[model samples]
Target: MGFSTTHLIIFLVIIIVIFGTKKLRNIGSDLGGAVKGFKDGMKDGTDRAADASAAPAQQVGTAGTAAKETIDVEAKTKV
Candidate 1:
C-alpha cells in the first residue's frame, strides 16, 4: 500500500535523528535564500528583456550611459 500519515511521520523522525534539528534548519534557510535569489534574478532578467523588446531604437539603460559604438571587420585565416 502507499505510505500513510504514520509512515510519513516515522520517516521524518528517522531523518531528524540522522540530521539534528539545527542542521536541518540551516539547510532549510540556505535553500530558501537560494530560491529567493534565483527568483529575483529571473525577475530582473525579465524586466530587462521587456525593456529591450519594447524599444528597438533605444537600448535599455540608455538614460544613464552613452550609446555604444559598433564596428565590423572580416575574419582572416591564420597563418
Candidate 2:
C-alpha cells in the first residue's frame, strides 16, 4: 500500500532526528543550487545556438552576392 500522511510524517521525523536540522538545511540548499545552475546552463546553450544560426545566414548572403558579381563580370568579358 502507498504511504499515508501519518506514515510520511513519522518517516520525516525519524530522518530529522538522524540528520538534524542543520544538515538537512544544507542538503536542501545544495539541491536548490544544483537546479539553478542547470537552468542557467540551458539558457546559455540556447543563446549560443541562436547566435550561431544568425551568423551563417549573414555569411551565406555575402557569399551569394559575391558569386553574382563574379558571374556578371565573366559574362561581360565573354561579349
Whole-model lDDT per candidate: 0.86, 0.93
Best by TM-score: 2
Using lDDT as the measure, the top candidate is 2
TM-score of each: 0.66, 0.70
Enumerate clash totals for all models, in the order shown.
0, 0
Candidate 1 Cα lDDT to native: 0.86
Alpha-carbon runs more than 4 Å astray in model 2: 57-79
**Model 1: per-residue lDDT, tens digit, 1-79?**
8999999999999999999999999999999999999999999999999987888666546744653443334545557
Q: Which pairs clash (backbone N, Cα, C closer than 3 Å) in model 1?
A: none
Q: Write the per-residue lDDT of candidate 2 for residues 45-77, one digit (tens) a residue.
A: 999999998998889879978886674555476
* Model 1: lowest-lDDT 10 consecutive positions: 67-76
- Model 2: lDDT equals 0.93
